[model samples]
Target: MLVVDDNSNPFEMSCAIEIFGLARPELGRELYDFRLCAAEPETRMRDGFFTLTGVAGPEAAESADTLIVPNRPDTHVPRSQRVLDVIRRAHARGARLVGFCSGAFTLAEAGLLDGRRAACHWMWADAFRARFPRVRLEADVLFVDDGDILTASGSASALDLGLHLVRRDHGAEIANHVSRRLVFAAHRDGGQRQFVERPVPAVPDESLGPLLAWAQERLGEPLTVSGLAARAAVSPATLHRRFRNQLGTTPLAWLTGERVALACRLIERGEERLDVVAARSGLGTAANLRARLRRETGLSPSAYRKRFGAGPAQPTAAGGSGP
Candidate 1:
């Protein structure tokens, strides 16, 4: 992987560095070989707060299997033609090109995003639309995965897309390992709309907050929307509207997702008993668990465990902060 930078945001760059740069021998082998490069050497980053030196030149991107363009300094102002030239050349070689945050503009400039759907920070939506009318700009989504050419929104969401890449390359278990190591929650297939709706930072604490907390605490107990509504002293209809307005999802679907997530967590933790996993996750019988697992993740319980479960004597130290 080649990381292209032009005064890139440190946080966005760190997302790639953490998963690809860091060493994890317990996983058996290196997951990714990463290098840092830019069109100019000793360039400033994060609005000149830091300077990157000793990075390779644009040639590094040509032979790289995956190339990343971190957030650029300005979208309206033109970046060096030399940088755009290298990006266009790399994409022609079928390299997986990713644009993080405003880096979507860099990809757009390179013509990689010309006809493909893309995503970027919502703040830059109008500028991107006005500048590149050809590209299908999805502002509401956290990220857009258009096969090899991927685009992510904002600095923080870059992590989501990076983890998603890991899941796509390896499997859910490995991706979940990376998430556990980073101390971040693993997000599912839905777009970033759910996140945008609740802006109180990680799950809101409004009217249904208490009820949501209660349901999470009792995930093993067969739950219903009406039961949750009664717990909150609201009619079922009112609760339904509240869920739709706040979480952008129906009550039962959200519950099933949570149950599936719990089951996955249990399976990933090396749970041996499938029946226990099903019962504990409130999916009832093993058949139900299998059906739900297959429906949500497209893998049966044992298959998911085999693909993503922890290996023997696996070191727990992999779960921590990245460099």
Candidate 2:
């Protein structure tokens, strides 16, 4: 992995390092040869005034099978030509490139994201779309995996994308194992939004916690937007507005995501009958589940199961086991 730094959010940088760098080799399926590469030899991060020790610099990127650009401090900083050149060269060599959060701006500046769909922090979605209008932007998604290039939405979505890379490289089992080790859910359905409507408060405000908990416990039941709105004691329009403001999506979209996530769990556990999976996920029928999955991921439910449900230890971009 090649982690580019521009003195951005050290917390996100550290999250990548801890998950992909400091993860226990003994616990991990195999030792990961991860590197913290940069445009400069030595970079100073904001965390603890810690000056990161020098690595091999941009030249080190040449040997990497995958490159990761972490979130930058400023999204508007013009990428140096030298930095863009390294990224383009590495990409030309078939190396998989990942841009987490605002790091997508770097890849966009390098021109790798031209005509490609990408994921960026939704708060800056309009600016990114206006700046790179040629690039197809998927705002409602947590990430976009376009062939050799992958980009993640803001914040924790990076973890989801990172784990996805691991699953792709090794297998689902290993990815799940590593995720368990990290205390994060192994999968968060790639189709899920980067931020949900009515997220639980940061300081345990619990204003929407009870409602979310109640909804989660009954995903298999019919969940209409009006019904959900009623549970929150608000009109459907009010609920809709709240959903947009908090989660960046509608209630129906959020419910479908939860159902899809449930279906993934079922398939991973070896439920092959499409009807059974659909019913369990509250997607109603096989056709509905198939349509939703295809719309969300451009893949059929069966294909997804074949690729991700069969194995655990596969090699992914995150350096865990997956394929």
Candidate 3:
């Protein structure tokens, strides 16, 4: 993996480093041969936060299997022709491409994102669509995984995309380990809405943390929206509103997502029987598990198991036994 830096934002760049560049000796193997490349020898970072130097030149991008494009704060500023040329060549050679935040602009400017689905920061959605009308922009998503190319909606969503890439390259168990090390959620559906009613509520709103934790532990049970509402001492309508305001999803959607995730982990841990996996994950029946797994992962139960089941057991981040 190579990060192409051309006056990029430090936060998104750091997210790439943290997710792909960092060594995972705890896992007993390196995840990626990560490197940083720049179009110029001395590149000024976003808002002049700092100057980056001592990185490989643009030529390094040609050898990388994956290229992470730059995300600059000034979206209106035209990217350097040299940088654009490098991205174009890399894409021509079939290397996986990534864009974080305004990096979507850089990819689209290079003419790689036209006629392809992508995501960018919601604040720039209109401008991106206006500038590149051919690209199918999913402004509501946290990220878009269009096979070889991916884009993230915001600076923080960069981590979400990075973890997703890790899960794609490795497996759910390994991705869970890496996410645990970062103290982040193991998975956030790419289709989840990026917008929130209020980033920081003017008045403190009731937190759903306790309720969420309670529900996670009971996913194997016959959990229902009414049951969750009852547990929270709130009406079903109030629970739905809170879920939408705080989590950007409905309670039913969140519950279904959790159950699917649990099913995936169980499968990755070498559970062979579909009926057993379904029951343990609260999916109820093998037929339902098959449908939900295929919808969420694009793989049937047996296929998913075949891909992720043969790996050695990975230890937990807290030095605990593997699940």
lDDT of each: 0.75, 0.73, 0.83
The local distance difference test score of model 2 is 0.73
Misplaced by over 4 Å in model 3 are: 198-205, 312-323
The lDDT, on a scale of 0 to 1, for candidate 3 is 0.83
Give the local distance difference test score of model 1.
0.75
In candidate 3 the C-alpha lDDT for residue 75 amounts to: 86
TM agreement with the true structure for every prediction = 0.74, 0.75, 0.91
From the highest TM-score down, the ranking of the candidates is 3, 2, 1
Show where candidate 2 strays beyond 4 Å. 5-9, 22-33, 46-48, 54-56, 74-81, 119-145, 153-206, 310-312, 317-323
- Candidate 2 vs candidate 3, TM-score winner: 3
Stretch of 10 with least lDDT, candidate 3: 314-323
Give the poorly placed runs of model 1, Cα more than 4 Å off.
25-29, 188-190, 194-221, 230-250, 259-323
RMSD versus native structure for model 2: 4.6
Error (Å) of candidate 1 at residue 111 is 1.1
How far residue 57's Cα lies from its native spot in candidate 2, in Å, is 3.8
Candidate 3, residue 42: how far the Cα is off, in Å: 1.4
lDDT of 3 by residue, 1-323 (tens): 44556567888888888888777888787667777888888988877778999988887777666888888878888988998998888788877888999989999999999899999999999999999999999999999999888999998899999988877676677788989989988888888889866456444536788899999998999999999999988899988988888778899999998898889889988899999999999999999999999888788988888877867543221001100
Candidate achieving the largest lDDT: 3
